[model samples]
Target: MQLPTTDIAIQTDRLTRSFGSNVAVRELNLTVRSGEIFGLLGPNGAGKTTTIKMLTTMLPPSSGAATVAGHSILCDSIGVRKRIGYVSQMISADGALTGFENLLLFARIYNVPRRKRTQRIDETLAFMGLTEARDKLVCTYSGGMIRRLEIALSMLHRPEVLFLDEPTIGLDPAARLQVWKRLKELLETFGTTILLTTHDMEEAEELCDRIAIMKEGVIAAEGSAEELKQRAGTESMNQVFIHFAGEFSDSKPNFRDINRARRTAKRLG
Candidate 1:
């Protein structure tokens, strides 16, 4: 189906980013519609996180352009930042502060009014099921609790666009499911535009309205998992992944071959 002609939460035009000698992301063009969940799926080192950073305005693009919530990444970074919330791969919180305190601090930073901050904090705490444990120091919170609080922190500002990088990266299956459920609830309740990166095919299938499969810093395929499976004449997303994986392997250097060549060059040196 064609994307709706409503507000676009994110749009990128040939977005590229590079380090000194290596390209991290290349010509990554994407659009995330308002009120939809968009998933960026790739294997490790496939530039999913790099592309996300650029889209979130955490990293400036080396070339091309992007806009978040209709604000340009280069020309209006602060405006983009105001309309977007980002959760990095690792949880960021003050271990010394209580869960409630941490959230209150963030509310202050986000410039939420003092009168409204308390109510918003309470709402988020209850929403994330952290109300009972709100007084406990972050150091005492469990992995699941910390993850929930991290998400709550990002959402406190009620941003139009939310970016989550590897949200369930190290969780148990039960915890992962709980997080997914909460994410669905949040989106349904608030109609927030979400962009997430994940290595788990099942997670993307379960949660994403659309999926983009990336490889070697560029999009390899895109569509719903079912759509991709149908196009590839397969019955499962795994089969589709396998088909694309084989194709990508043919174009990229073999890791083993590259390692052997490196050893030979070292010896010659």
Candidate 2:
């Protein structure tokens, strides 16, 4: 059945995906409203990335349907792609290129008008605090700087909904905080609705207005951080994750693996 929609930014109905005998995501029904940060929390191989791939039109679902930014993933994938931005865990910035060069490249890729590309890139660079480093090669940037650049690249087209898969996987606390700050600013500046997957409970608690915990390919629980904590009877988001997600692990290549793989794929692409 279709999920009820009210001021919705994203909605999925019975969305399922499988690999032969394995069912990665099973009949997911979800709704994310406009202008809110929604977190998708799950253990490794719990279908977080799979769901993202399907929703973002990177992978087709085995059954069911989804709409992103009012465009169907299956029938109007291109339309969906045009209205949303996605930043995977992978580092998308070209280390061999300067930060400015990277944004210029992405601007062209996003088909930003030639008349607006330079101004847009500059504004984005300043917004992400990368103006000073714009001329520097991305190879020399810190992990946080690289992450910020990736986010900036995704935002060059000014998407209405941004999907982030493990956006802050391997950063120091300070770097993570910086990324968190920029994300909040992005939400306020663009009113972009964000849906992100992360293993970090602190990141989820800090950035998400609401969170959904998935276990074994289905949503086990969902709510605001405090509401979930109340349901789990704990103050710790970690404990809440444990209670909902359990210790399940899988052999499927996890998001971190995909992050590194995509870096290599970009080199080969």
Best by TM-score: 2
Once fitted onto the true fold, the runs of candidate 1 whose alpha carbons sit more than 4 angstroms away are 1-5, 247-269
For model 1, the run of ten residues with the poorest summed lDDT? 260-269
For all candidates in order, the CA lDDT equals 0.82, 0.89
Q: lDDT winner among the candidates?
A: 2
Q: List, residue by residue over 43-105, the lDDT tens digit for candidate 1.
A: 656788778888777889999999888899989989988888888765587889998899999
Q: List the residue pairs that clash in candidate 1.
A: none
lDDT for model 1, please: 0.82
Cα lDDT tens digits, model 2, 1-269, are 44445478999999999999999899999999889999999887788889999999999999999999888999999999998999986667899999999999988888999999989999999999999998999998888888899999998999999999888777778888999999999999999999999888889999999999988799999999999999999999999998888755543656666667557444323
lDDT of 2: 0.89
Which pairs, if any, clash in model 2? none
